[model samples]
Target: MSAVTELSIVLQHDIDEQYQYQPGEIIRGTIYVTLAKPTAIREITVKVYSEGNVSWKGPDEQVYQAQEVYVDSSKAIVDTTYDIEPLQLPQGRHDFPMDYILPENVPSSYIGKYGNVTYTMKATVVGANSRDTAISSEPFLVLRRQHIPVLAQQPLSMTASRRMLCSCSFGKLDIRVTLDRGGGVPGEDVFLQAELKNQSGHTVTAMQASLIMTTVFRAQSRSTEFRQVVSKKRDEMDVSRGEGRRWTHVRLPLPPYVPESKLEFCDIIELDYVFQFRVEMTGGSEVRLEAPFWVGAQPQGLEVPNNEQAGRRIHKGWTVRGSQALLFPDGGPGDGENGAGDSGGQQPHVEHDYDEGWGITLVPELRNASEVVTNPLYQHQQNHVTKGARDIPEELLENTKL
Candidate 1:
């Protein structure tokens, strides 16, 4: 019988492999081997082996194996070896380049824990003239796991952001506008004073800002939407300070484009407009803020609600005259849900008149029997238009130095 020969192995890798590895990353390395001395050998086969275990108590109160997993022959060298009869290297030195592919399911193992995975390559050689075999195993680590103590001792977070629905709290902003009816006549000029306030702490940088007045009618059965352009609104304010304010003055000239015959009374009249804001720093991120308010008719002699304020009114016959001059720009209202507001279906209607093209007016009829008016139509809109700017009066703006 022949004696078993000794084998030595060394694995080498570079430092650029860490910090950039993915879950399914493949680890690669070379197995450099040097034979102890020239000896008779048939072939050298390399095998990668690994095992994972879990502990459990048996019925007899003794520890038992709950899980035992293995990965063998994971990688190998088919017919690579130092055979004594075939082109052998000198007796003093011998080397062979070998590799084993890492298995995708290999778990990370470290220290003495069996839950961690380890890789070992063995070079086994069969004696040419004897019945003996030589095998050598080298230990290797898969991936190091983070220390378990730190993860176990960390405390849970309890911030407001951690609470349910707390993340949705961007707060509400209030925009106020005053349409002076003193100068407005059957076919004269109308003046609008608008104030925009940034109620939220975040700065709003919009792509395009517009002050528009729209006519909306909503009922339990159906709804109609329309708008009137008051002015060519732009986001002229670079940084609307948090809880700060800005103002704009607009004048409009009305023409009798719609005949007085087309007007009718409805349950509600909605005047809404949208201001598109985008991240000026990124040019790619954008958000559109819509400011909508409304006015209602009290059925010729009905009392206005204690919470309601007078907006604007026109004779029933003038509705068609306004409709005849409606001008909407293509891709004006925007597209999709993110384009403007909710993308439900029918395009948003823009209300405008071309009598003299100076300014525009939005006159809407309320559906007398409608019960589906959203709370924003009655509460938020009213608050935004009437009381939103009381805290910051005209005197305060006039007295403050830039």
Candidate 2:
């Protein structure tokens, strides 16, 4: 007698393989199962859940992990037994449709090096025998609704002044920074306008602007923060007393991989960003100004390019090789093709040469060597520079001197 040998499951969604959705949207799909022969089963069940996983290694070689289940649900489609003579029948294929509506306040799905937010659906078949259970699962993506507050849509501007007395001589420096808008999304450019007036006796050496990201993680009563410079632009200037320098339209391109601010879905983690403008003065305290902003997901119908296209647009020196092109990590283009170039009509392979040094390099090592260094005086004044959703602190504003 022939018995059930193989079983399989397939998930189908209205959006095909994209599997992306916004909050409060209905996720509708169908599950198909194939059986090789007649089978007896107890019940077929399906489950949907959201999960967050955090894992990292400490400096002392210790491993740490924090995981949580945000949402979970299960349903049974076939809960009756098929052991009866009339109810039992030969099976070749079966199909079941399912649907679920995502909650309104769920956090956006994300994948990172140390943590991730994932949503998944699983289907299980429990046979009459305890050991004959079969199961399968599939993952989908969810994007949080990013809305810019009314006040954040207005222009952002800030100014600061610092005076230094050295060797019985005093000088005053004034700096101002402004942005076209206070909020932006990935794949967009932020226009920075800055003014520097060196009224002090000291000469201005240089000026710099940067976009920074600060991420905070809270795990079991312990909280830690990390800072990363996402993008930066600098200009060298020599300004004596009463000389002023102005930057009209300095552009800072935001990369598409940047996540939105305030990941509210994940309660244990938070994120923030800022734009800093600094004027270096010779033999005197530096003038520093900051403008806080938001980086959020692009609204629907905005039509921002994907990661590959965004990379090419931001980095003029980027050379993306074709799928059939030969690539060597340390070798030049003259190296012969290694016979792996033939992708057989699939998506072409692309590579970026960060050594050219035209745009923002996400690699930490490369950025450290290429990006302008933060002035030592400014670094010593503050252990970390961060701007969050709340108002700027009075202490932070008062400590603008470097």
Candidate 1 lDDT, tens digit per residue, 203-271?
445423343444444333334455555434344334433443444344444321111111121122223
Model 2 misses residue 23 by how many Å?
Answer: 2.5
Give me the runs in candidate 1 sitting further than 4 Å from their true place. Answer: 1-5, 14-37, 56-60, 74-89, 110-116, 144-402
lDDT per residue as tens, model 2, 1-402: 223344344443433443355555445566666566666667777777898877767777676678778768676666766455222436676776555556656777766656778888888877666665678787877766576566766788988878867558887777888888887766567777777777777878888888888777666565567777888887776888877887776787776556678887787667788888877777655666776778766443333223332232122211222234333342323235422233332333345434432122232121122333221112223446566645422211111123
Candidate 2, clashing residue pairs? 172-200
Stretches of candidate 2 exceeding 4 Å from the true structure: 1-20, 36-42, 54-67, 81-95, 111-114, 127-133, 162-174, 196-208, 231-246, 255-259, 278-288, 296-402
Best by TM-score: 2
Q: Model 2: how far is 341 from its true place, Å?
A: 63
